[model samples]
Target: MKFVCYTDWNQLPESANALFLQAEKDSLFFSRPWFENVATALNDDETMALACVVAGSKVMAILPLMKSAGNIGYALKHRYTPLYSLLLAKDDQQQVLACLVEGLHQLPLEALLLEPVADKDGHLEGLQGSMQAAGFGCDRLFRFYNWFLRVQGQSYAEYMAARPAKLRNTISRKKRKLEREHGYDIHLFSGDDVPHKMPDYYAVYSASWKANEQYAGFVDTMVARFSKAGWSRLAILYIKEQPVAAQLWFVGHGKASIFRLAYDKAWKPYSPGSILTSFLMEYVIDTDKVEEIDFLTGNDAYKQDWMSDRRERFALSCVKSVKPAGWYERFVASLKRILKKQ
Candidate 1:
């Protein structure tokens, strides 16, 4: 087995592309297009690199890495990224992970930071173990909470019926009130119409309570690319032709991820966000028939009302103690831990 790092996406071998295709079957976040968008939109001072573990002509694993501050590395991720991890081929996953861990040591990195990794999969756990076995000091830090719903073969009506009575009533009452007061319309755009409807989405988001997007054009470009791939589920709620709420969702591999959601503060009293969510939920459950719905990040109380289960996301910080820089990082980490304990 050999370890190879490619700085340019175009320089990646065909074998690597095949591995990415296999990974995409698991989550849209692992798809090449998603990674490309992240690279192009999120990159600032960091230099992106694709680290791979190859056995002959076959690629075993691919780690999306960003080199920053000369010797420190991080996952190629941004605030918009809900989950991040190394993409590995199916067969011999343990072996491939070990090889990948070994390959990571070949880089000039003293410390590597991987964040917002889902805890459901054993991949990150295996990676932690492998890094420890490779003589690296690893720390697992809590990042955020992820709420998700498992459809479990239930119809949309059945699913709604099981939700909390208060939630059901609120959605029903608010939706009715909003429609009666302003004649609201909810539109789900997935394909050719997504690009054209982006202006409405931007308008609603800008008027919402959330802060402006740190990376300009990131969400727009992502929605456009995912729309072209037939993975977008952009929903907009309009009251008399003015957008009041907008949500960007992606449906792929039997799962729907709620990527971005915002509602005009002016319409918050009418609960346009919740109403739009309810509409999107019904569509995904009854029409798209997705097996799972993920509320990707955050522990907001409202998420629990819609989601059935909660999972934790964590950051894996690894330090190569043999290097002086790594030793300094370890000292700082140890000091922080001690202070927290106190």
Candidate 2:
């Protein structure tokens, strides 16, 4: 295998095509167009992309990367995309992963920080071995707990029964409230139906944030990229003609991701977010379209209520330079060693 690193995307243009195609054919996480679309949204400094391929062949796996000054390795994205991103590829995941580590070693940077890695095995194990053999037992962070509902093998009712207790009760009661208290219509954006509803979607998302004093332009960014890449959809629940709850979902391959959501402030008492999540799961399970539904972040109470499974996603930190932060990092290491001796 050869690791081909390029400073520019156009430098080895065919490489991306071959690698992306291979990812589409094999790997679920790598198949989504919006993965790259979202990664491109995070390019604050120099963006570096790498592809690992058989020496004389097309491509095997690719690594999309971005370089910042110190203590940060980006998933190579533009400012508009999500913070957690890496390249999307299918075959030879470990090869692509090792290539990224090796390629980072080539640069004269301080440290390598890959935040929000999606597939834990594809990189974590192989990269950990490589880093340790080189005399570095780098830090791994369990920053966020990922939530996912397994909708592939069971019916909605069956899936509900498998859950603990309170969740099943909530789903049953919420569905009843949605049907009885007021007539609720659930609308989802699909295919060409997206454009007409984009503005309304943005209003609900932004307003939801404004009420809490936290703002995320990520909603608008997600809409445009998902639409451009043709890899996303939105589901909204309306009560009496006003949009009360909205769930924004993007599908890439057999895995569908529910990343962001919003709801009217007036209906917080009704638990709009929870209801929307439950309904979305029902929709996916009923259609049998996606095998896994990823909440993608947060160890919050809501995730436990919605998802049947949990996977902790970790960030890999490999220290490179002996500069300023490196000094503090060394001090931290010394502290750890002293603590161990005690």
Q: What are the C-alpha RMSDs, in order, of all predicted structures? A: 3.1, 5.4
Q: What is the TM-score of each candidate against the true structure?
A: 0.92, 0.76
User: Any runs in candidate 2 off by more than 4 Å, and if so which?
Assistant: 21-32, 43-54, 77-103, 134-137, 164-181, 209-221, 228-230, 321-342
User: How accurate locally is residue 28 in candidate 2, as Cα lDDT from 0 to 100?
Assistant: 33
Q: Model 1: runs farther than 4 Å from truth?
A: 42-44, 92-95, 323-342
Clash number for every model? 0, 9
Write the residue-wise lDDT of candidate 1 on 206-250 in tens digits: 899988755558877887788888999889998888998999899
Local distance difference test, per candidate? 0.84, 0.61
Which 10 successive residues of model 1 have the least lDDT summed?
A: 333-342
* Candidate 1 whole-model C-alpha lDDT, 0 to 1: 0.84
Residue pairs with backbone atoms closer than 3 Å in model 2 (clashes): 39-77, 40-78, 41-77, 41-78, 41-79, 42-77, 42-78, 43-77, 43-78
Model 1: lDDT of residue 131 = 90
TM-score leader = 1
